[model samples]
Target: MRVAALDDDVDQLELTKYTLQAVGHDCHVFQDGDSLLRELRRESYDLLVLDWSLPDMSGPEIVQWIRDNLTERIPILFLTNRREERDIVEGLSCGADDFMIKPMRVGELVARVQALLRRVYAEPLPTEQVWGRYKFMPIGRRLEIDGKAVSLTQKEFDIALFLFRNKGRLLSRRHLLESLWGSSNPPGTELMSRSLDTHISRIRSVLNLRPENGYRLSAVYGQGYRLESIGNEDYEADAQLAQSQA
Candidate 1:
């Protein structure tokens, strides 16, 4: 999980970073709420670990900002010294999913994080998924075919996942570029569009995606590209017929 942690205390922030990283989470720490909020605007996070008292803003205020602005579902966990019943209620009312008093126990903290993630995000998808001879581990960004690992660059993996998730849909060059490169070409400057074709070609070669292998990645004339599943007999017959006519 990608987590953003906010605490004014330097020592506490470091400890939180170490503890969360120990549990296989990528944690970024901030000394003030403003810095954390700035990072939040640019990147998406799965969870937020907040301190009630901060130099700039209170934890509840940060929570409110997140709830108001961010589109992604992010669970907030408050790690603070406030221990009164009213304090807990206020934190919960402000949209924090869980609250823990300071002097936190690492074990309990980790457990609460896991519980909140499971409850809010619904298990976060399995680490590995198998489709016939292909195996994908999105968390590790790894792919394997028939037990042999295939190396992929970061953008290649991102593109492959995007295509696989949207298989059977015609993904336009604009959509692919925006999805992978974060932006599409401006008016009259479609030169960068060819980059998508290159990536698609590389992905098809690496994955051995073809009609014979139960997968086909094909261009759609003036439309775009489609990744089709040809595993069924009807689709196989159609593919054979198309080949014969060509």
Candidate 2:
């Protein structure tokens, strides 16, 4: 998962980044609210770790800005020095999903982060998952559409599954690469770009992702990709056809 953290204290920022990276997450740190907000405009993160006090803007203010502007419900966790009960209440009320008082313990931080991710992403990934006409068997890394199999490379399966799991969300290219590669600094070379595009194209072709099929896999110009369900019209047609067959 991709995480963005904000903290004015340089040492704390580094520690937080290291902690998240150690647990297989790509972490990006910002020293001020402005830079973090700017990145949020172009990039999409799975979660956010924020400090209550900052050089420019308060964490709560940033949270409010995100809730007001962003359509995606990205999870936000507050790791701050303020330990007051009122502070906790205010943080949650302002839109943070979780709060932890610091001088942070590494173990506690990891646990909190994992718990937040699981709750937000619906983790403990099931062996078999289905969406509309497509069914995924993660253990075997196999995908099926209407009971017929679709061949995919391991990398292609990973990318396709990630996009399906995060359907309706605009995932930035960097986020997709980091999630697949598990590298904080994913190679942004032209070769890597072409590889990703090729994989997406292949998945679309194999899955027959079209509106009549009840799904659409599309590229978001300079952003990345989003898999979305068109509407219930197609779903209704499929149900009627299935009923007629029955």
| Model 2, residue pairs in steric clash | none
Q: Rate the local accuracy (lDDT) of all candidates.
A: 0.81, 0.90
Clashing pairs in 1: none
Residue lDDT tens for model 1, 149-244: 999988888888777766675665655665566532344436557767888899999998887888989987765677888867957798789989
- Which of the numbered candidates is closest to the native, going by highest TM-score? 2
**Which tens-of-lDDT digit does each residue in 180-230 have in candidate 2?**
877657666567778888899988888888776778888988888889997
Error of 2 at 199 (Å): 1.6
Candidate 1 ranges beyond 4 A from true positions: 124-246
